[model samples]
Target: MADGILYGKPISYFPNGYPLFIALLKLIFSDALVPTILIIFNIIFQILSQYLFFKLLIKLNLNKELALITLFFVAIYPNQINYTRQILTEPISLFLLILSLLMYVSNKPFLSGITGFLAAQFRPTLIFLFPLILIHEIISKNTKKSFLLGLGVILCLFFFKILEYFNLILPPDNLKFNLIVATYSDSFNINWELARSKLSIIKNPLSVYINHLITNPLDFLEKRIISLWSLWGPFSVTHRGILEKILIGIRFPLFMFSIALFLLRKNLLSKNILIITYLPILVITFIHTMFFSQQRFTFVVEPFIIMHTVLYLYSFKGNFLNEN
Candidate 1:
């Protein structure tokens, strides 16, 4: 797609923002060098994201040692590190999303909005977070900050519109296709061919989803239950290597353990900061339950899980020592 755009054949698909950015890079440097450059950028983004994650932990009042432990875990997580080898949106999107949350906690709402907008361009599911943040600010009675943040997002949207007007890029044109594929359970396979068959007959994808919910409520619930498992479970429907499978197996239990701890001990931590961190994670998880769910999709929010888990472990240790 980036090559097509460079050669004057821009195709409209789901969120071309990352490809468009890649095209810009290709225009600047030789094609051979672009891959190397992207790998370097991915590494840099990962490093910066870790730094911001640590900063966020401190801002939320976590002890330095515990925060460093969380940072180390995030830095070494297999899924997080493996993506740097490929030319994918995860690295940049993760960096920007973490930076946005840091800015929000630092009381820089405008900067938060700008980074959040950039993150959403790479991963459109993040767009749900902006309205949630806006509502959060309004409820907190920070009207001025809310307005500035909203203005920042609106300015970015205007810039996107200008790009669209000049044909520099195209709007997302694959929502119906995504929705159709999402309707099918991905427990065994994606079955896109079957989804396409359904899409051909269905005029409105939204109505199809709604009618499915209304007619076969039990089936709808079952599919969603499978999707939730697909999103977080250690097993995969597709084939994976033994080493990759082991990493996922380790990660899944840790994620669930951290979540259980957080639920039981949330009141003991900084509620506001933790809420800010968890809100997007919850939103994306819910959205995918309706659409499609995959481990890669869940990767965007795994850092928070790491943080929560590490925090809980340290707190537990401290309490144990005092008890002794």
Candidate 2:
């Protein structure tokens, strides 16, 4: 798709934000060099993400040692390193997401909103949490900042509309497909014909979901539960190589353990950090439960998970004993 775009072909599928970015790179350099360039950029983004994450921790007043430890883990994280070799949106989206949070915590709302908008373009899953952030700003009486943030998002939307009008890119048209797919467990083999039949009538994904919930509540609940588990499930043993399997096996347990500790010690953490880190994880998890869930979808929030977990461990030193 990116090659097609580079060759001046119209993108008939979903909006090609990430692909467009890749195509633009290909335009600047030879096609053969594009892959290498992308990999390097991914690595750079990963490093910058770590740096921004450390800054975020400091801004939240977390202990320097704990923040450094979290930074080390994020830098050496297997999935983060592995993703740098692929031409996927994860690395860039993760960087932008972390940067957006950092900007927000630093009270740079306009910059935060702009970065957040870009992150959503690369990974639309971020869209689910934007409203929650806006609401938080309003509730905290940061009216001026909220307005600036809203304006930033609105301006981005307007630019997108202009590009869409020019037929440069198409808006996402996968909600029905995602909604249909969400009805089944990741392990289920889907019948495309039956899926298409359902999709043909699904004008509203929420309506379809509600109907499914009303008609077959148990099946709906079961499938959603399975989807939730799949989001955090370890990499497949049969499909992945031994090293990948071993790395994920170790990482999976640690991720879960951290999450457990975060939940238990959340009260000792900063509310701003909680809103920026913990809430997005929950929002994404909930969104995936209603749509299609995948382990890769969790990548965007993995850093936050690490940050929350490390902050939780840091709390045991009684540093936050006076915190409400």
Which candidate's TM-score is highest?
1
- Each prediction's Cα RMSD? 3.0, 3.1
Report the C-alpha lDDT of model 1 over 276-298, residue by residue, as the tens digit.
Answer: 76887788788887777766777
TM-score (C-alpha, index-matched) for candidate 1: 0.91
Cα-based lDDT at residue 176, candidate 1:
82
For candidate 2, report its TM-score.
Answer: 0.87
Candidate 2 structure quality by residue, lDDT tens digits, 124-222: 878867778998889989899999998878888888888768766667676667777776434334356766787767678667777888999998887
lDDT of each: 0.79, 0.76
Candidate 1 at residue 26, lDDT? 93
Residue 302 error, candidate 2, Å: 1.1
Q: By summed lDDT, which 10 consecutive residues of candidate 1 come out lowest?
A: 315-324
**Candidate 1, after superposition: displacement of residue 152 in Å?**
1.1
- Which residue pairs show backbone clashes in model 1? none
Candidate 2 residue 158 Cα shift, in angstroms, is 0.6
